[model samples]
Target: MFCFQCEQTAHVNGQAGCASTKGVCGKDETTADLQDLLIYQLKGIGQLSERLRALGKPDQAADSFTLYALFTTLTNVNFNRAVFTGLIAEAARIRDRLRDALAAAGGDVSGLSAAVSFQPATDLPGLLAQANIASVRAGLDLVGEDVIGLRALILYGLKGVAAYAHHAEVLGEARDEIYAGVAHALAFLATDPDDINALLAEALALGRLNFTVMEVLDAANTGRFGAPVPTQVLTTPVAGKAILVSGHDLRDLHNILEATKDKGINVYTHGEMLPAHGYPKLHAYPHLVGNYGTAWQNQQQEFAAFPGPIVMTSNCLIEPQPAYRNRIFTAGPVGWPGIRHIQNDDYAQVIQAAQAMPGFAEAAPAKTIQVGFARETVLGAAETVINAVKSGDIRHFFLIGGCDGAAPGRNYYTDFADHAPKDTMLLTLGCGKYRFNMHDHGEVAGLPRLLDVGQCNDTYSAIQIATALANAFGCGVNDLPLTLVVSWFEQKAAAVLLTLLALGVRNVRLGPSLPAFLTPTLLNVLVEKFGVQPITTAEADIQAALTRQAA
Candidate 1:
């Protein structure tokens, strides 16, 4: 039950992973073992799906299952052992069905590997027995830590890709290429390549794959919700019955809004859902109130104090505390052991909970925060931005974004954003912005100095904006007066980092700490090849980024 895929892995006496009875995220050994077994079966499904694709007989259901299954394995997404055990069995069933179909189609399956031929145990003890062999570091003695670390990097990156793709798929947006890419990557892991160089290259390949997933998601979101527009969201609580939707799933929020509309209940966005207020279609809902809290890490405290029911739509859910466990709901791939989960997107139970509970009795004073500066909204005023740069009115562009966590040294990001020059524009995305989004950075040349560019998956929007700025300035993205200071917390952030490196984007700073899975040798390789640097102090990093322009 060794897991080090997130920023908060157990680090004791020079140890770097969560191999004890319970993970730092509250995932116990049994749940972790079940998750490993499920992932192992998913790899088998991936192998079969890849083979089926080669025969020109790809199964859409298998593809969707693979994506959702990988997403559930992400940090803080799902901790329900029963849910994982069922999925493991389903994966084996899909693999066997696909194998039979291939044989019926005259494709030879006799030479296929054991991953395609082996059967999974039906009981918990038997499954745990098989998990030791299926674990991520199964052959660590032979392949060594470097190879194992690189493999974990690739696998974690793919998990992030699957999460973003899953969000898009539920919104009626998916690509066969993405499905194929996911299957190929998962199957690649099944073979356990020991070559460090090859494994590193595959990590970059997963990065490029994540870029495609992010693009599909960007289109799906904007196409369905309309491009994000600049809007001021009220932060103060309103006097009414309410339901708070958290995590990154816009579809869930949209459906909940529809269900609770005109029902005397107000819906507010929390965590990464804060950006939903920027979407024109979602913003049109009158009862869709405002953002309730900061990032996912603070949910234990925030959810406890909130006066209504809460719904976690996707990843980054911590263990639900007893105070709010019964009232909080899980949707999509998100789950906890005993918490109520919303299947089929039905919100009747959640609505009832909100109706049954005491909501805000009196309206708090209105306080506003600006959001929705996605690519479209920013590019609509690109000429103004470009003109400011040309006239020396804008000194620099700083992309201070990524996932946030409870770890130390994260305060560097808050200080970095707050300390940036008044003439500089700070472009932010992901839940990390919660650290300083409320801090007033003022404006520059008629534009808000701080730009909130949607969620973490909306790194696509950040890329688009950067590319446009580069094109207008007649320079490469790196040559622009922009610096990427990314604060990573989980696999999704890892995938985004790989995307930046794969695209040859250089001099990006990543912190609060680098992934524990990355060995010192692998870290050196990243530093030398990609110009990736571990973040120092906010004052030093800000000065270094600004000084680069002078050179």
Candidate 2:
């Protein structure tokens, strides 16, 4: 049960990984083993799927399932061992189905590895025994740590890619390129190659695929919900029967809003869902109230204190606190052992729970923050931004966002955003914005200095904004007065980081700590090739970005 896919992974004796009975994120040993087994089987499914595709018999269902199964393995998304067990069996079924399809197409499967040809046991005990051989540790003894880390990077990056692609698929957007890419990567992992250069190139390939996944997601989001606009969202609670929808799933939130409409229930967003207020179609519901809490790490306290039911729409769900355990419901791939699960866009259970419980008794003091400065909104004011830069009213831009965690070093982002010069604009997204989005950076040239560019899911939007500004100024992104300060907690951030690197966008300041999955050797390679930097002090990095000439 060795895992280091997230920022908060445990450390012992200068090692960075979680290998105990339980992980830092509350992932128990059984669950961790099951996740590994799931990945192993997914690789098998991917092997079969890739071959089936090569034979001109691609199965969209199998391809989509591979993405979704990978997504469920992401940190903080699912911890129910039973769910993983079921997924493992389902993976076996899918693998066999694909195998049969390949055979029907007259493709040879004689020389496949155990990952492609192994059988799954029907019971948990038997499955755990099967999983023991497939744990991440299997490669450490063979390929060594450096090669193992390289493989983990590609595998985790693929998981992140699948997450974005899955989100886009939910929104009725998907491409064969993304599906095929996932299968190919999965199949690549199945072979367990030890070639360092090949693994590095594959990781970059995953990044390129993620870029397309993010674009499809961008189009899906804007196509369905329209581009976000600058709207002032009340951070204060509105007194009413309430349901707080967390995670980054807009489709789930929209459905909950539709079902709870006129039901005397107000819907508030938590975590990454805070940006939902910026979308026109979503915010049109008057009952869709303000954001209820901060980032995902605070959910225990926040979820318990919130006066009504809670719905987790996607990843970043922690184990439910006893106080709010029964009232919290899981939707999409998010899960906990006892939490009631919502299926097929159903909101009846969540709505009933909200109505059955006492909501906010009194309105909180009125406080508001503006959001929805996604690429379109920011670019709509392109001339103003350009003039501000030319007139020296705007000296620089900071993209200070990513996954937020409860780790100690996280306050750096808050301080960095707060201390940015008034002449500069800060573009923020993801839950990391919770650290300083509330801080008043004031406005520059009729635009807020602190721009909320939607959620981490909108990394594409952030990239687009930077690229547009670069085009306007006639320079590459790295040659612009823009810097990326990121805090990553899970695989989604990993995928985004890879996208930035693959785009040759260099000098990204990543913390609260370097990824455990990145051996120093691999990190040095990135440093040499991409100039990726571990974050220093907020003051120091800020000064460097402001004064350093862009390369």
Candidate 3:
């Protein structure tokens, strides 16, 4: 159980990784090993599926399975071993079917690696037995740390891509090109390439692929929910039977809202779902109440105190404590060992749980928070923003966005946003904004000082807004008075960072700690090539960004 794919991995002496019996996220050794086995089998499916696609016989089931399976392996998404067991067997079956299809199509399949040809174990013991060789560290002695690190980067980025693509797929949006790119990237990792240069190129390629996935996701979200508009959401509780929906899946939230409509349940957004309030269709629900909590890391306490059922729709779920475990339900790719899972968009069980629990006794004092400042919303006011910048009323723009974690260093983002000068505009996205989104940033030149672009995947929106701003000023994006201060926690943030680098977007500050997988040499390469800087104190970084803009 060697897992170092997240920011909060345990650091022992000079080494960084979660090699103990349980990970920092509460994932046990058994679950971690099962996840590895699932990924290994999925890579086999990827190899066969890529070949099958090349033969003009693409399997939609294989493509969908790869997305869902890869999504489950992301940080804080799923911890149920039984779920992985089923996925492993299914992946093996899919791989065999694809192999047969490829062979029948006259595609040569004999030279494929063991990942495409190996048989999956039938039971738990056999699966555990196969894990040692299938794990990420299998060839560490021969390939070395730098090669292993690069492969992990590409693989982790692909996992992030799969998560975003799955969100888009559930919304009835998917591109064959994105699917093929995901499969090809997974299959490439299976070959265990040792060339550092080739691996780095592949990582950047994944960044480009992830950009497409995010674009598709943006389309799916806006197409289904309508473009986000600036709206004020209540932060206080509403009186009624209530259910809290967390995670990043708008489709699941939509389904839950539909199922619970007029049924007396007041739905409240939690975590990344906070941004859903800005969407016209979602906000139209009369019973869709205000946001209920902060970021995912605070779930244990928040969920325990809430007097209603809670439904997690995607990643960033910690192991449920017993206090609220029975009332908690997992949906989509999220799962816990004993927590009830909502399948096929059927949230009947969740509704039943909500009905059984005592909701808010009475409406808490109404308070509001503003959301829905995505690219369209921001660009709609482009003239005002441009004028403000030109008149020097808005001196700079700071983009403080990314995934949030429990680490103390994350407070730097809060302080940075809170302390930004009144003349500058603060832009935020992702769950990281939970740290300071609630804080008042006062207006700068008639516009809200703090603007939320959207979810982590909506880094696409941030990119678009920056590009638009650059075009408005007739300068490159890097030449604008915009700075990106990213707080990374998981693979999704890693993929976003890679995209920024791939696009030649420079002078970005990344932190809450660097990825444990990146060796010193690789880190140096990023520092030199992309001008990526480790975050300093909030005051120091803010001053530095302002200094760079002035220069």
TM-score, cand. 3 = 0.99
RMSD of each: 1.0, 1.1, 0.9
Q: Which stretches in model 1 have alpha-carbon errors above 4 Å? A: 108-111
Clashing pairs in 3: none
lDDT of 3 at 444: 88
Q: Candidate 1 residues 345-446, lDDT tens each? A: 789999999999989999999999999999988999999999999999999999999999999988999999999999899999999998999998998999
Cα deviation of 142, candidate 1, in Å: 0.4
Write the residue-wise lDDT of candidate 2 on 396-467 in tens digits: 889998989988999899889988888888999999989988877898877889999998889999999899
TM-score of each: 0.99, 0.98, 0.99
Worst lDDT window (10 residues) for model 3? 108-117
Itemize residue pairs with steric clashes in candidate 1: none
lDDT of 3 by residue, 386-476 (tens): 9999999999999999989998789898899988999999999999999999888889899999998888978889999999999999999
Lowest summed lDDT window (length 10), candidate 1: 108-117
